[model samples]
Target: MSSKFKKRLKQLHGSREKRRRQSTQDEQSRVFTADDVEEQDLGIATSAVDAWRDHGADSRPTARGEAHFLVRHHPQSHQHGTKRLAEGAAVTLEGFRKQLNDARLHSADPSRLVFLDLETNGLSKTSFPFCIGIGVWEGSQFGVYHYFTPTEADEPASLSACAEILRDCEGLCTFNGSSFDVRMLQRRFSHYGIEHPLDDLAHLDLLHLARKLLPDRNGHKLSQLEEDVLGFGRTDDVPGAKIPGRWKQYLKTGSPHLLLDVFDHNRLDILSMVVLLPALAEGLGSSSDSARFKNRASKSDLGNRPSSSGSDQQARPPKAKPKTKLASQLSRTYALRKKAQSGGRRQPETRPTEQARQEDVPRETVKLAGSFSRAKLRRGMPIGTRLRELRGEVERLEREGRGDEERDEIVHRLHEMVALSPRNPFALERLVDYYRGTGDAALADHFAKRLDETSPF
Candidate 1:
């Protein structure tokens, strides 16, 4: 009986091993089939030389007989997502300078400003830029140009071409060029013993502007801004981290198939900057003008108000005006406050007119979480006001049983609310529940820990 039992256990073990081997074989076959499908879809080119030509890029020869890939797009015919490339020509640099409050851009010419973006292998000083995309406004048309180096030897020619394109431009506009792109390009030019064209240009880095304008935004990445501000969303764009590997693959296999997406990525970046500038300018202008108008109105009200007391009416002492910017602003604020307090008693509180009441009525309730205006939150409302509004919205959404439909956006609102007021247990509990519901164990743990730390005994 013991022998029979041992035999049965051995047979079970053997069957399990056999099934594992079969599953491994099946997985290997599936992997091979997926690879085959991918290869077939790529339509792999035969040689590097032919691959580039087939990729719709023309080659231009240099002094060392090396050539770089060149792809050009005419703004007259090219439309990047929803924005017409030609609309970039309509933007004025003077307006941008005034709106952005940058005196450096006072002399920046719109036609001479080049929109620049670079794709690099890595961030290290030793690493290099493989692709440079630039957009230039020429008359009524915007020109998009991409310079790609096929090999290390061809880098000089590509850099030279990029320099030539930028040499005539007076100003440079980039998303984060000040930190990465400009520095990288300068280092590359130094490495190649060539004169960098960026030295003389008036640089306008949009990253800083975006941060100032969209302060409440989660991130200021170009892709994020494209979605939030420009209403353009990228579909199936290659991840940036995977791009360097694709280039290495192209070098090894003589295929431009993968680099095709990289090229599109670079093009969209340049075009997005072109589309982003006007939007930035408009937003900045409106905000600045509104604040200025409010300040002026407050000062006017303070000035027109009658004296509150006999001493104020006498005005015997002549006071020196504030000399510093901060002092002047503070003085105005103090005067406004005094005027407000004095006038409150003088003017009787009257019932709201029909038009006033109608205006105060809550706006048509938006069903989706996406309708929450980030800009409105960023407009300098009191923290308590923002918290109340956010909490009220969350409560309303809960009452309506939004469930998974607006999960991500609801989470976003909670995050912003929590960021503004961390002590609030409501936001913390909701976040913990959200992460748990979404099966994000790490985030759930984090929020759970936070909830415990903040919980009252």
Candidate 2:
């Protein structure tokens, strides 16, 4: 057989074996609670966990556990709280205030606000949320609330638990909840015949706020807000698109590990809102405060400058330079690289010229591609299209004798594409070509080996 054909066959075999092993392991290790057995004996498949395990083995553990745990744990707990946020502890008004206050002071919000983030199945009108996350500011502390679709026969009950928490809040905040999260929740409620309380709450969406406040900003993602304003970072959080797969994994295997990561990611999103609320408040509030202060200082300087023969103007503080063009370029590049990595793309080398135009790449395009590459790839568009575009642009530049200016752009784009679409043959081939063209035979061969290994007949 040809090497490519052999490799493809081997991959298929390995995939089959992996699936079989996972199935066997799931069946053997499945957690069988008395409740599940009771439901089964009654001829009712009420638990999503049991139903999932019956169908697909090798499911994620945390999601299964999350569903199972929610059902097993009573919705009402008498331990130090009034109502269950999700079958556990009630978040008191005092606690909420304290958390809100902390976020406000630390992040410097004049209004002392909170931000919310959520992940759902799709962006389509028909899409519904299987998971929800909320970020709230309480006093001086920041807290998060997350809910996953319950595994019990009563999915509505799980949603009710989430709705109850939201009802108690004086204000609701989210990044794009108005357009995405809220609407999805509303649809789910409608589907289940449940009532949604968010309609009455004081809702604040950061998406609108971000655009209004930072009109020149390239993107308005929560992660971008975190990096640009809050100066925070993250790593290895599962992409939102992988959430469904993780949920499926839990259903099959009854393992909670992958689900925990999802929960953590959701929690981080909630916390990011907490960070963002204050930062945004500060930016808006402090701007006027700063202007007033500057105007007063300027008037004083003007009066003194004339009387003192311009000595006061000279003595006054020098105007702070706007972040240098170079610095701005670097920041933009860093932000893009960071975003690419978060979305499961590779980080590229920071070439100086590429850094200059980093802002030119539409943030939405990058996000759309990163978040929906699986569907895109299924449609026969390789995940490396963006990288290809960049390489093509660079090649064109090189042909025009703008080699130095274009080289950095080429390298950066290649790096990001390779990082995102590590499995793409085109990206690997280009990397091989790039190294070969640049006289890095060793690196070229390294990529060549990877290409050969992953290539299908």
Candidate 3:
């Protein structure tokens, strides 16, 4: 009898493992067009919508068939945020702009940028996004719009809310979006016959970047980076892998409030991205721009917003320490040598056997040597908003024979364009044109070098 019982347990384990593998295979298959989807898929979308309607879950305005979903919309403003930077590398928006330009992206507007994270019931195609948390810049304040799917039927409405929010976003930032979050959501949208909306947005996958810059670090996971680079850590947070089980328990028995931890987990994920942006942007600067940006966010009720899980663990951000003058000078010398080689000017190779000849890492260079991270810096307004009007203004000014005045205004705009996007070769080239037209050889040459340095191609 004991042997029979053992045999049964082995069979059960084998069956579960087989199902897990099959689910993974299903997730790998994606729907791209109507030809790939069955008409029955649309019914699932409809039933999900019906579920929301039947449950009387709170509704938000959605364009996709007036579907109602449980929405947890928290609009934030007028609150001073109390979060403080732990005095790591100080990075300015301007500094990050340089890196952005290097990445060769067109724009990274704050208002049009949405930080997204999703929680789901499963990892494979069989699962749907149960919660979608979006951190967006609302005027000067940051607001998180969480779309909660309380039941299976709420899937359609929840997805629609996310689609609506994403429609206007110019870019999306995620820790590992390209691999999981994005691919899974796209699959969900395709399965439901709803158009995938994020295909066009500028996608910043922080995980890829972190891996590139922190190759020597112990691990490149967000949590690892939080501990190593940002000095922030989590407390009593629900493990992501166990989230689905918690939700399933809620659905089956509805006895526990453990789902709140999931929502809070989603919330902290959004905030972690928020807090890390400027710090990652700063690189090894003397002090972090986190404090500066936090101050800007503090004006609105966002100041007191909690970015971490609990107050149990405080971030042990690296202390801001200046490098000794000797170390700083040697670091510069080594940098110059590398830059010269990259410039194809290396003429010879020599090895120094003398211990003193070997340049020691300057303490100052240590900060700059830290691995890179990610974040955003706000600009005046979204790009498309007044561009046409500005063009019209320029045309009118030019037609009215205010060519010189128009040039000045153009220069002004160009200055802003350059400041906002230093890597913009077009802007740099235009500045070169303007300077040349003005017969300012020095200015023209200066801009030309700046343009050359900023150009990605």
Top model by lDDT, which number? 1
TM-score of each: 0.51, 0.44, 0.46
Model 1 spans with C-alpha error above 4 angstroms: 1-47, 61-66, 76-82, 95-104, 287-457
Error of 2 at 166 (Å): 2.5
TM-score of 1: 0.51
Evaluation by TM-score, superior candidate among 1 and 2: 1
List model 1 lDDT by residue over 1-457, tens digit each: 6999999999999999999999999988874568787776445322455667766777666543445666665645566555666556566677657645677678777667889999888778798988888888776677677777766656888888777777787789999998999999999988888776687777878898777755544467888667555668789999888988888887787666767789889888888888777666655556776454333222322433444343344322323455875455345434432432353234212223445456675333322223335576688767788788878867876777775534544565676566666557898798788768756676677667767978776
| Candidate 3 ranges with C-alpha deviation above 4 Å | 1-57, 65-104, 284-457
User: How does model 2 score by TM-score?
Assistant: 0.44
| Residue-level lDDT for 374 in candidate 1 | 56
Q: Clashes in each model (backbone N, CA, C under 3 Å)? A: 0, 30, 19
The C-alpha RMSD of each candidate to the native structure, in angstroms, is: 19.8, 17.8, 27.2
How accurate locally is residue 360 in candidate 3, as Cα lDDT from 0 to 100?
A: 60
Model 2: runs farther than 4 Å from truth? 1-38, 41-116, 123-127, 135-143, 150-152, 286-457
